[model samples]
Target: MVSEEADSWGLGEGGSRSWPTSKPERVDDQVTVLNEHRRLSLQEIDNARFSWIHAKICFVAGAGFFADAYDIFAISIIVSMLGYVYGNEDGNLSPWQSTGLKVATPIGNLIGQLVFGSLADIFGRKRVYGAELVLMVTATFGQALAGHGRAVNIVDVLVLWRFVMGIGCGGDYPQSAILMSEFAPIRTRGRLMTAVFSCQGWGQLVAGLVGLITVSAYKGAIRDASYPAIYPVDCIWRIIVGFGCIPGLIAFYFRYTIPETPRFTMDIQRNIAQATRDINNILSARRHTVAKGLSSDTLVMAPRASLADFIKHFSEWNNLKVLVGTAYSWFALDIPFYSLTLNSSAILTYSNFGKIDGNSPNDVYESLFRICSGNLVLTVAGFLPGFWVSFCLIDSWGRKTIQFMGFIVLTVLFMIMGFAYVPLNSTGPGQHAFIFLYCLANFFQNFGPNTTTFIVPGEAFPTRYRSTAYGISAACGKIGAVVAQFALGHTLLNSNKDMQIVLEVLSFVMFTGILSTQLIPETNQKALEYLSNESQEAYITGAIERGVPLYA
Candidate 1:
């Protein structure tokens, strides 16, 4: 190899070589240094013992998801409240307007995923991490403050702000998942990521708790006369929507100051020396500060990311399959997941849960109370437990195993619910059985594909494309949510037999999800590099001195 390189360069006259300027030996030596340092740091990260840093990273990154979920689902009951405030004399929002309000967030999420997902890769995670939370916090507050403009009703204002908040909500999926994946130890990585993603269950539960609390707080006014007292009803929704921002506000500083993953600092920035120093500070001392002798000029130019490089990497079938697997699995899972979550009130009402008979203010109070209480019960009975169960088993049982099993169970549950809808709703006891089945579906979703889809994409791709790929995958899931809200949600609001058909459709989607799960290789207890399916040798090709970029 040396003789061939010498022959190619014609370094033969007296066997003397060009020295100092653009020295070939310098490039080779730098490659060796990059390889050695990168390998050591990655080993340290993957095998490092569990510590407070891991816990801190889990919660800080996860706080965004909690806030996002709270805002997203809180709108379910809030839509009903807005109906009292903004709806016409009929005390109802037009079906189109209601769907639009509910669908806005998923639309925003799709945009945020595509935009911020790539930005984090191009700039840096730390720079992009807290940015979406800003959008969430600001837009959430904006929703709380929305009022009736002469031309635009409060509903229109809410749709606008919720869409913006949705974008921020969407951005959190990739950002949080990528951060946890990059920072966590391999053995405990799945559990840590699960712990982070499980915040959604708690968020949903709290949305209901807050909804129930607010409705009860205004109980007297709601029961006094005709429709729910408009002022208190307005107050209820605002309080719930406004409260969603508190978590984001609290975690904003920590997220902004969060350390960049050593993987990104090494692989994307190409600074292995600095990356090693980062691993030491984070793992050894649990501090986010960088070591001394930091240089602004250092640039390790090894396989820099580009449009062509990204295309080439994922073009391989092995790589492309995983991306497809994660994307479609999420898409399928969310078709049902969001269909149920975003429309839980409608679905529960369809189930005749705590049904009442009159149209008076007392009737409205009883109905809204039932909706809030039922949501809380569903969440407590199903969502929270499913999340913790996944948390406990993710590391041991493996992601694919749990996903496959969950999908299978979910498919069965949906089929039974759809096929037996008439019989299930025929009797009071049967309706109770139907709700039990409903809760079971919720349980399997969190315990199954819902959690794993978020996890696999974050870890499956290479460091350079990790955030971008996860964004794409998560964006696809949001697309499913959008479709469900726009198409199925609109249909289900009819409160008819359509839910039977929706359940059937969900069954089919879950079955397809099962097929997609076949494509996702098990990410259980595996190193991120192993999942990337890329060669590791000679990872450092060269260096760019003094702020010159090797690849734009």
Candidate 2:
């Protein structure tokens, strides 16, 4: 019967060679059959060559990240413009309002990661993927239209819309990472994941460029003596915020069209027929002839995952330790990472790198331009290169070593910048020195913990719980971001007296991240099944008992 079904499907004699001739008569045989099917499905994915389909997957996943980065980082620039239009005597965002604006998205992000991450695992990746992008597009437009009416305060409206946008952004993190990781061939899985994440650098760059262009375009209006310094009240910042929706819109179609990853379809959903069809479609699209020739009737659904199952799987000390390591390392990394990246303009301004000469409209415009320009230079010099370096070396040098080095180096840089805060901010040469350290810190962030933290969670967990574990780890990181933005950013970094203290604390945080790195096992040049000891043991034992070759 199996041979006939395989023949009818054009699989021929070779295709049915290993398929069981009858239903498994015993419990262990049943388990072995199901495990072998899953193992083969994953091995197929891991060994497949790179193709245009892979590129499509990367772009579809990457576009969400681009939008995420643009929306999150654009706020920093917009805040500067807001201060110009609605400046009090201080002519800057008050620490309280700044904290609210910065922290709202992360709060929303925490909820999104928890909700959507679990949903992806339960409902399947394709079903839950594009909805977040839609939410983001709507919220981004709302943010642009915010403050148009007099009834609500502008900051409150922004806080509301941005918080919702943050949810969408948060969803993208797990969805994109897992989708790309699942689709990627093992030989370049790390690089592929890194490639998708590298979109963040582009988004950061675009944010700065948009700020510079919009502010520059409106410079003439600001320079008009007849008009007040804030004459074009809604023009500049609205344009900047509104521009973020473009990438999401462009990527929406592709994201919606992307098929469910074969691994998810087979391993989690336990639908071998559909999984095989999807894989064949991908191969056909890529002009490859290999097909799994799996029969839907012969394949049985795995038990649906539940909370109890989740607990049972992760309760083991080894699995629990991985979760802990990923969560805490991300937390420690983001404290300094978010605080620095989100507030780069403020830092530069505080350092007098782009000081405003006067309260004139022209002066304000130029200062915004200079600040944007400074950010662009730093992002281009340090941020983009770091991602590319990781892209090149992630699969070769391995994740653990790079992450450890990054934490160590970043710790030293922060400590130096912290203790020498007075000197670094004083003379011209000192300012230059401080800027170099800051840029270098940004470099190591992408080259090390920032990129690795995001990648590790997606790879380390089993498919049934991959999205959920990734989400939990990510949410923990956002918790760190919230603390940094609200707790440390608002309180300590707000005033000059406490700036050094903030840096010193961040240095300590990075060092602690170094300790957490010890918990992560190296995953270089290994298949996903081999990453976790349980999965590796199952694959090895199953292969031996069934008299089949591993990776076959």
Candidate 3:
């Protein structure tokens, strides 16, 4: 049997010889540990008879994604309503003003992501998670009560409030993804993470539904020229924005009760006693058998790592490469993803599917309905498949390969939309065909880069720095969001007939994405924990062998 000191040093010690010590031996030990960990993780999953706890955590975190999607999209709905309130009596607003309101929130989103994301890493996920919820609620409610005049000049106030809310929303992306990933079992990691991530689709869908409801409420007022009745238009929009708060409140209340991750506790908190109990409980609950030699008191744990130590751990070249690759992929995904959503109303306005104030009765409602219909279809198609793909193939196919496929397809789709739009065919099958291609692009985004970009930041980092690393990566992504939001409105889709111009801009951006993706290595099958002492040594040494810079 292994002695206390031998076990203290782990499998490499005790000089058992057969237990693994050299590099090859260390690889063998990793296989053994991986096999054991995989089994234990699976057993724990089966035992979590309170699987609903897992589901609840997922839902709570996911609600934030939904809110982010909804809040961002609301900018478009409100802009559409604004056209009716303060445009030509015939009901059309200038494109520049329309674009400004639509894009301002994304700018806010970028700032929020960077500021709050870093906080999640420095503090704990639970604390920041709760605070962000309160911020989101306050800002959204603020938007609801902005002003009522025909030319209500609260644009600055609305923009600032949205920006504040965005910081909270931006905070949600990393916090939720990291939180869900930690709670998930390895085998089901993809499923749980993707499921939570897919909440964005639900949020978008809710936005579409809300748009439909809002439009329906105004249909009567809009149709009757004489009555000119007010339809809680501002309140309706407020309620939609305010709706995001309910889920956040629920998440905040429950998040306090949920324990920090056992892996996090093991890696960062160094509370081995509690970590061991949680780990064993997770395993025994699933397998219906006690751990053979494990006891809470007997379990040895690593010391809590300091921030300096954490940075020191990743001072190697390859580590930095992986970090850069992951961050770039995230940045690449956001440019088009956010640009499309933030500018979707402008796209619809130019598409001319219907008019806001044409001669026809209920024309605005019809136009709003069509946009919502398209969004609903796209969300269901892309997000639902994402959950399955991430669940079944993430480990098997690997992260880099899956993301590569996504980027490549996205590139091709963008090119298709670009070519279809170049001539700017105003009327006929060409325009309709262009619209179809645009919808297809949205579909591919959901199935491909959208899911993978978010997934990688969570999977790539160790638990101790998971939130911090994710925040950094997510902040980079929001930088892209800010650029897309502001630029697309000013340059890409600035004109009513520039649909093709917008497509070309995104196509150019997506090509760069395909190239940036080449930097990432495959990581699907690798276990998240430390492999072995020799392997850890090798990780440090291998980088030096290749002349990779070490930070510390």
lDDT of each: 0.82, 0.80, 0.62
Instruction: Name the regions of candidate 2 deviating beyond 4 angstroms.
Output: 1-34, 148-150, 225-227, 284-303, 355-357, 535-552
Q: Model 1 compared with the native: what TM-score? A: 0.91
Q: Candidate 2 on 1-552: residue-level lDDT in tens?
A: 112322332222224334333445564664565555555555567667798888998998888899999999888778777776665654576777777888888988988898899999999999999988988999999988876347767888888998999999899889999998888876788999999999999999999999888877887887874434775635888898999999999999998788888878776766665676677778433322222333453334344579997888889989899999999999999899888888887788777866375767677777888888988988998899999999999998889999999999999999999999998888999989989999999999999999999999988888888899999999999999999987677764366657788889899999999999999878665666566545332332222112332222
Alpha carbon deviation, residue 373, candidate 1 (Å): 0.7
lDDT of 1 by residue, 1-552 (tens): 112322222311124322111212354554555454455567668767888788888889778888988999987788777776777666578998889998999999999999999998999888888889999999999999888878887888888999999889988888899998998877788889999999998899889999899889889977785554677677778899999989999889899778998889889987765776778788744422322222435676677789999999989999999999999999998888888887788877777874355557877788779988998999999999999999999988899999999999999999999999989998889999999999999999999999999899988889999999999999999999998988788888876699899899889989999899999988776678767787666666655657664322
Instruction: Compute each candidate's TM-score over C-alphas.
Output: 0.91, 0.90, 0.80
In candidate 1 the C-alpha lDDT for residue 435 amounts to 94
The collision pairs in model 1 are 108-167
Which structure is stronger by lDDT: 1 or 2? 1
Higher-TM-score candidate among 1 and 3?
1
- Model 3: residues with Cα > 4 Å off, grouped in runs: 1-50, 87-96, 148-152, 225-232, 280-283, 286-314, 354-363, 380-392, 422-427, 530-552
lDDT agreement of model 3 with the native = 0.62
Winner of 1 and 2 under TM-score? 1
* Backbone clash total, candidate 1: 1
Q: What is the lDDT of residue 495 in candidate 1?
A: 67
RMSD to the true structure for each prediction, in A, is: 7.3, 6.5, 8.0
